[model samples]
Target chain A: MSSIAKKKGFGASLWDYLTTVDHKKIAILYLAAGGLFFVIGGIEAMLIRIQLAKPDNDFVSAGLFNEIITMHGTTMIFLAAMPLLFAFMNAVMPLQIGARDVAFPFLNALGFWLFLFGGLFLNLSWFMGGAPDAGWTSYASLSLASEGHGVDFYALGLQVSGAGTYIAGINFLVTIINMRAPGMTYMRMPLFTWTTFVASALILFAFPPLTVGLFFLIFDRMFGGNFFDHTMGGNTIIWEHLFWIFGHPEVYILILPAFGIFSEIFSLFSRKRLFGYSSMVFATVLIGFLGFMVWAHHMFTVGLGPTANAIFSVATMAIAVPTGMKIFNWLLTIWGGSIKVTVPMLYALGFIPSFVAGGVTGIMQAAAPLDYQLHDSYFIVAHFHYVIVGGVVLAILAAVHLYWPLMFNQMLSEKLGKWTFWFFFIGFHCTFFIQHFLGLMGMPRRVFTFGADQGWDTFNLISSLGAILMAIGVIILVVNVIITIVKNEKVGNDPWGDGRTLEWAIPQPIPFYNFKQTPLVRGLDTFWIEKQEGNKEGMTYAEPLSDIHMPNGSIIPLVMSFGLFVASFGALYNGEKDWAIPVLVLGLAITFASMAIRSIKDDHGFHVHKEDILKNEGGNK
Target chain B: MSHDAHVYSKSQTEYEYTRRVRREAMRGQVTTFAIMIFLTLIAFSAVAAGFSEYFIVPILLLLAAIQVVLQLYYFMHMSEKNHGMAAFFLYSGAILGFTLFLTFLTIVWWN
Candidate 1:
């Protein structure tokens, strides 16, 4: 019995993960996949820096350079950062709310597989012909003019992946809304779960526009439609409208979770309850609400005229108020409390100043006239990297360190973590901060190279050097991860000793079924409150010991996603191949067959009896 | 099981009564669906006939807005639970999205 319960061999573990429908395991899959993409995107960044290291460099061809930059942006934002945040949310949120699993476990597995296969299909373009060369936005006129299958790949890949994201978002919404533990009121939920709820709602609303836009693009390119062909009585500006409507909220979708992470860190390390919790929640929802209103701020340079510009500009500025409320709340969260300078706290502290700089620049761009000069310039690039890297990426790194023990029962070495933070932080500043000045000096973005006499050479070199430093920092982080996993040093619940959320209330390795009995959430920071009241168990259960129902793991989701993967290839080759139609039909049949089977089958899940629970009580501990 | 059978039947009867009440609550949704179908037909007809294209577009858009409300309230089950707050959030997003589209169209096309 102990041997069966102990660690299995490699193949056994592999099989377990391959068929696992557990949300936590799915989170690990997202992390692993997202981490791979992050590294690939980072390498692309290095290539970009190398090409621009000196003025008039010709290391990479212009077309190829465009492909690299396009993939870098698209991959980082969609594939790396968002999924990594999803990883954290999946790993923690259910535990926070004291749910055994997400609302739809099968759908969760399908979501991960769809994302994986879609990303694979997109990157396969590199070997098949070429990756997407149009900028990540793939603005209509330019994309329509571009040759080869690059834009086609972008549309199809994003459509598949975007559908997956939409599914995951809806799942989070239903899970958070309906599956909360007894006494876990909306107001009493942890900030991260709250942000996940709001961000998921944003995703639910934001992604449909992108889906519609991608459909239009696909039809125009592949199916002989003229939605974007201006000469054929089609309007190109419609594409811009559709993309930004999705694009603007996409930014908030990425950053709001970063805000949630910092909120948790501030309260935890400072040993203080989050100040003005309700107001912080209010601000988050408000920012998400206002996010959809300001899409046209990106169109100031596209000449939407004064009335459109002024309305969007004002609406864009209004977002700053809610965001400002959050900043003050964080500062107050740390005020007059015992502060600890952990590696995560360092990133949180660094994020405040860095993200403020990014936020202010965003406001500056909100001024319509000012943005006319800044649009498509290095300044816009600098502003977003500060927000994305300085804000979101930093949060990912911090959460990796902070939540490592919670997720994997191992702690990343603090010594190495601090080293990673400094190098990456300094490198980030060096790389992006100078680009702001470069933009001010009349440098346009998305250019392969610049002329030497333009006085941009030195800054470009410095930026390239900075990129190398950031790479080193990432290498150190990888080393830390390897070391921690190999050592496998165990940590107990509340590993930080000041964790304020329910996620930290569970012991390490976090049993396949989290929370033998659901915890009764009392108030904001319920776990923290329980700790203050001297509860060593770290929770107060709402229910007595009883049999717990658990859904059986299934491989059907993988088969379902694989069917779509096959159909995507068929769709891609529809006109080119003789067998394409048959393949498409077969693939779709597989998917529908699986769906039919799932719908008709009754899966009354088995229960872990009370005696089994007693037997396993101290196993994880 | 033997002793409780009578009580179980009584509870089942009560559940059937509640189910009937729930079905009655869905009468509003039947009307909503009918109205949606009617509006969609009108939109297709106006666009197809090409009559007063300018005025027809606005009328069509207004009807489309009504259909959106019907879908939200009826199909999405938003009417049953926390209806006020859910409606507030959904409508706010819709209004903002519509405003963005209109503002862009006015500035870029009308101007």
Candidate 2:
């Protein structure tokens, strides 16, 4: 067994990834799958823009256009953005806290598989019959009215994926709370880890509502349930309340980590400590708390009356103050320091102005009366794209550039990166900024097509042009990635030259098992402090050398998730087929059987001898 | 070694730690089960007592809220360390859930 562990070939490596429970390798899996989904979603976005390039254009049929828009929104949010963030969190958080792995590595792998299968099932609807034609929200009335298996795929797939998300959330919570290295106090933790902690907490509370909502949807469609049947004393609006209650926080869950990423980048590139660090932490917590309060703001035009609207409007506006505080803190951190305008720094700079524009418009919409005019319009679409694309997507791109060396031990070309950045930045604004006017000019959103002479022709054409530019920008990014991988140029630890966090202190191609000795965190920005004092070791040991206990990777998590994936199909086909019940029971029995084995089997982990550590200096030294 | 002595006595058994956690889990399960039963009884009684449907609905809602609290604290372990932060998150969700409910009722049911 030990001999086999020392080396393997391509087939063995592929099998290892399929079944392994290592958080770092699972992160790579997430990146590959999530990147694939991102491109698919991007192609869908281009199609929507093309169809809208001219009024009443038949670039796609009306039904097909709805499906494209729906898939675009759903894919971008659930499959692409969230998993990419999870990739970074999985890859970086344990290393930051000096832990060898997350608290439950098996569950981590299970989460990835569940998400991957769920996404695949949803996309398969395109080939089987049709895709979900309702909007991304899949509001109750529209979804119920839609025919075929589109909405069913939407409900079932989200149910499976949402469960995966819940498991991942719980795992992060336990890992952060229980696994901090000695001397790594809560207050001394990096901003990125703290945000991950808070975001996981949000996921814990938020996803259950979505689970409940999707369950109601599945029951309504497949079974004989009447939870959302308006004629049976059931209220369809309840679904809206449930969806947005989960949905609004889902927005913050994506953006807050993006904010955390930029916070780390700004401090590193500027060669200065974060200004007002404590206040920044306070504002982060405050934003998470207030994030739950503003879901009703999304419901303003649904007729909640004056007082309810007024109260929610005020509550929604309060979120802006803390957000404003964060913006100022980032600028102040770079105000009097040696700021290097690298590709990442350029994106961070771009984010400030772009996100601010999105923020102010959000404040404008917080006025209940003003929202009545903008609801279900292109203006709302523009607003979110600005916040999400302008803010979160930019941060993801910046992190790709910044953390490339940390994750892969290679640096992307700076020249190609900057070109990608400008094209994307300019094209993004060109696409979305004008949509606000189209909405005010009386164009409704989510309509598959519109007639000519609505005053939206030129703006829609311009938006389509911008979408092409954005695609070009994305292509350049792909080129940059391919070139870098081909060159495989190795970089040293602290490749950016001004690293401040614990993650940067670790050696490149970070060992599969991250830290040999737990690091003693002296203060905030521990690495920077040690650098100033001329400590070459880059860290003080928090503990002496000892045998490190490590869990063995297994294939059970994959099988368990796959069992549930198979059962979903059985449940969907229940009434039409004779084998449905048996198939469902058989699938569940497989899952439970694996779980029983897991509980009964006593598999204490193996240990790495101290000598093995000495021999492996080349790995992560 | 001295620090270890202060945190854990040499005579203490691993069994003691395991026993304590087991007791906590057991107590939590019992409390959560009791609350669920009590809430269900209240909901049923409200319907049987011929109360106005409006009154019955509100009473049922209140009982459901109590059950939610029990589940969160006992089953979800929200009452563990960092209780203040945990409570803050729960209360935040409750407040938003209430606002959404009220807004929907007002808009669709009222004028």
A268-375: candidate 2 lDDT, tens digit per residue: 889999888888889888888888877878988777678878988998999999999999999999999898999999999999999999999899899999999998
Give lDDT: candidate 2, residue A194: 86
Two-chain DockQ for each candidate model: 0.22, 0.19
Shift of residue A507 alpha carbon in model 1, Å = 2.2
Model 2, runs deviating above 4 Å = A1-7, B1-111
**Candidate 1 chain A: 10-residue stretch with minimal lDDT:** A1-10
Could you tell me how far off, in angstroms, the CA of residue A18 lies in candidate 2 after the best superposition?
1.2
TM-score to true structure, per model: 0.92, 0.89
List pairs with backbone clashes in candidate 1. Answer: none
Candidate 1 yields a Cα-based lDDT of: 0.88
- For every model shown, the clashing-pair count is 0, 1
True contacts kept of 2: 0.20
